[model samples]
Target: MAITSANQLELLQTAEAVAREKMIDPGLVVEAMEESLARAAKSRYGSEMDIRVSIDRKTGRATFTRVRTVVEEEELENYQSELTVEQAKQYMADPAVGDTYVEEIPPVEMGRIAAQSAKQVILQKVREAERDRQYEEFKDRAGTIINGLVKREEYGNVIVDLGAGEAILRRNEKIGREAYRPNDRIRCYIKDVRREQRGPQIFLSRTAPEFMAELFKMEVPEIYDGIIEIKAVARDPGSRAKIAVISYDGSIDPVGACVGMRGSRVQAVVNELQGEKIDIIPWNEDQPTFLVNALQPAEVSKVVLDDEAGKIEVVVPEEQLSLAIGRRGQNVRLASQLTKLDIDIMTEAEESARRQKEFEARTALFMSTLDLDEFFAQLLVSEGFSSLEEVAYVEIDELLVIDGVDEGTASELQARARDYLEAQAKAALDAAREMGVEENLIAFEGLTPQMVEALAKDDVKTLEDFATCADWELAGGWTTVDGQRVKDDGVLEPFGISLEEAQDMVMTARIVLGWVDPEELASAEEDETADEEDEA
Candidate 1:
């Protein structure tokens, strides 16, 4: 095709049509055309001749030019694209080393091959621009619901056609075995929007907890407004779900508002979820109170919380145990997800037996360690003295508070407990030394003789070993594996060392061993303080 033979204004018209069809800027289409034309010009001229093209925005007249950069004699590498100062002097009166010399050139009359190449370039650029437009339009819409037509299904994954672009709802993200036919209307949450080599990929989800939250937001005006808020949501996809909500306006009950006047709001969400049963509970700041509320339809006799482990124990009546746990532990699992805590539910009878077992264990420990009879050891255990260390170090007045325990009897108990502890410590110290424990570690503050022995057994015999250990390695923590909390045993965990205390001890060891710069720590601490103050 002859470039000059065609109507010049056709360039602008074509650009406008492509831009409108692709929903992109017309200027971008013009730029792509200019680039394609330049490539064709380079093919006609020398490929290394530095050819460039510019089309006038209004007239659509294509202007081609060759650019040659001025450089020093030693730096002139590309003879076709660059020129030395001496060579450029003929083009300019006074050419500098960095100046470029652009000269006008005739436009190429593209052949069939060149024209096809240009067409390919234009299509590629238009596709890219379209993908970018689709991504920009849908990125901010994530976490919200959108309606689309089901385009097709690929390996159980449904592809939905939004008016602007296509989105994918993976099989695992669909609510149970929900199937869709071509052109069927479907609503989904925009889970994510990602840019890929082919185009922007919009991921849709129907089983996400956020999907339920968004559905409620659309159905409940109070949630859409600032009057009520959805605090947490847990779902079993098509089977069942739970949602906790709170209200800012005291007059508006959050759960009741969400439930609606005739169960309309919650029912709407339930219908969308394929008849998934929902348990709506009120949000509470107190975790125990919240758990009690979360485990609805079953009365909780007692609640015990282990804050450090992020676990809770719930005691219910014998008859209510199965109801509390729900079908196949689904109820408790959803409650655990909602509260962000691991729950162990048992009957009130089981709880009483467990308490009795613990009391017996403590009583036996006191009887064997302090050389006291059953009655006296039980008395000490009943007084809340669980360990020999507590009995040895507690104030004399606390021991005197126990029945039939005067100052003399308290002194005798203290002497026995200390003697036993000291003897145990001596034996542990000997064992640690036998295991290559160093004096530096023994002299280190905070760690007891038994702790040292434990560290030695764990291969942390030197102060350097302690400094190199991670906080979680020295203080036990819970790990979630396959959605179950597993206990990680730490060397110092038996001594009741917390994560914070382990961190402090490690930092102190590092400082004492000259492994850490105290001044740098101080500087970092000051920076953190400044950041907190600024946030406040």
Candidate 2:
């Protein structure tokens, strides 16, 4: 082969073009190409059975060559194929049968093949290096918004130039209410950055809910300063968004502050969000009230919470139901998501019906004493003791201990209880007479005239009737002849007996009667007994 001046110039030009295309140093390409050609040449005629072609990158010169082992007999077709050890020793001072001897062959064409293979390897490496570089650049940018130039649209997505790389803005990520033009500057969230065959592929979005949140951060000085915080946010992108905000200082009205004076601040955020409507609600610690406010423009009459279910039923006027639910259920849906509640909306009328049912159920618990004073009825309700049985079974002293009761009332209540029991006993006795137990004795001997007078006021007559009385209802939990507790610190203050004396007398009466329940005795003993003993 002949090396021509024109051929050398052409190869030089080809090397420069290939290096430029692959972004590599032209000198490295030339070195690699020359090394590969030399190895090919050795493969073509080396001791084993073939010869090869070679190239000189610097000189544009090329050749073919064969290599063979020195052998005993030169029986092979070419001298390069084999040589006798004795004969090889003449050409080489120390030649062995297995040793390879290189034989230079006539020149050959290899410049084109070497150049093509070199270009392929260079391009593949360049592509991989580019991918790695791009991945490193964008991975740290996730969760932040970046500005990108609109490059072109492929299929339905817009390819964006992000400085050193490109990102894809899919149709779903685009603000549906807005359009983009070529070369337009746009802000998009770096939703994700992933490695791909071409390079690091970035996914961008303009309609993510965080888009509005980011815009708020950018617009609000208070938010940036951390004086106000965004508790939660929900969006119907391209249409509306709801954000619950809280201020660390009570002096700051979170909603008003976020909205800015006359809507200036919020409008700026809205503009950035492509005019998406923003409702800034003040965050509340009270869940019911917070939820009520989250469904704004709708006045809430009440919020009923079912703690076990984490559900809230809100009662609003009929007119506000639509407002509460929003357009196409967007308002309530966002409210539920923002507050993490399953919200049910009801009208005032419906709530009234439910409350009435509760009241009726409470009323049904009383047996015969439904005609009690309305104030007493309200007291029962306030104490959360809504049933007659609860008031009936409570002891007189315990009833007086309730928040609003007093001792004097508790004593009067005890007397009434005795009378009511006596009435029941009489009724039972009548039933017994019609059936049988008429032999039972009625004993008023131990009772004082004052005690008898107190029961007579309520119309009590018999012991059988007294046994059926509810002490708490009659005594109001405080027993008093005047306006004092019957037993003040285990003593009768009027009689000047320490608690010990009252205890002894009551025990004496219980032992003497053998049938008296001490708690049922009106007094330890009548004053007449003391008067008679003093006279004796």
Candidate 2 lDDT tens digits, 210-315: 7777778888888889999999998888888899999998898888888988899999888877788888898899999899889997789888986534578999
Model 1 C-alpha lDDT versus the unseen true structure: 0.93
- Please give, for residues 1-536, the per-residue lDDT of candidate 1 as tens digits: 65563668899999999999888999999999998999888888888889999999988899999999999999989999999999998989899989999999888889888888899888898888998999899999988999999999999999999999999999999988688999999999999999899999999999999999999999999899878999999999999899999999988889899999899888998888889999999999999999999999889999999999899999999999999999999999999999999899999888999989999999999888888999999998888888988999999999988989999999999999999999999999999999999999999999999999999999999999999999999998988899778999988998899999999999999999999999999999999999999999
Q: What is the number of backbone collisions in each predicted candidate, taken in the order shown?
A: 0, 32
> Where is model 2 poorest over a 10-residue stretch in terms of lDDT?
487-496
What CA root-mean-square deviation does each model show from the true structure? 1.5, 24.9
* Model 1: how far residue 10 lies from native, Å: 1.3
lDDT of all predictions, in order shown?
A: 0.93, 0.68
Give me the runs in candidate 2 sitting further than 4 Å from their true place: 1-110, 249-253, 357-536
Best by lDDT: 1
* Deviating ranges (above 4 Å) for candidate 1: none
TM-score of candidate 2 versus the correct structure, residues matched by position: 0.52
Checking candidate 1 for backbone clashes, the offending pairs are none
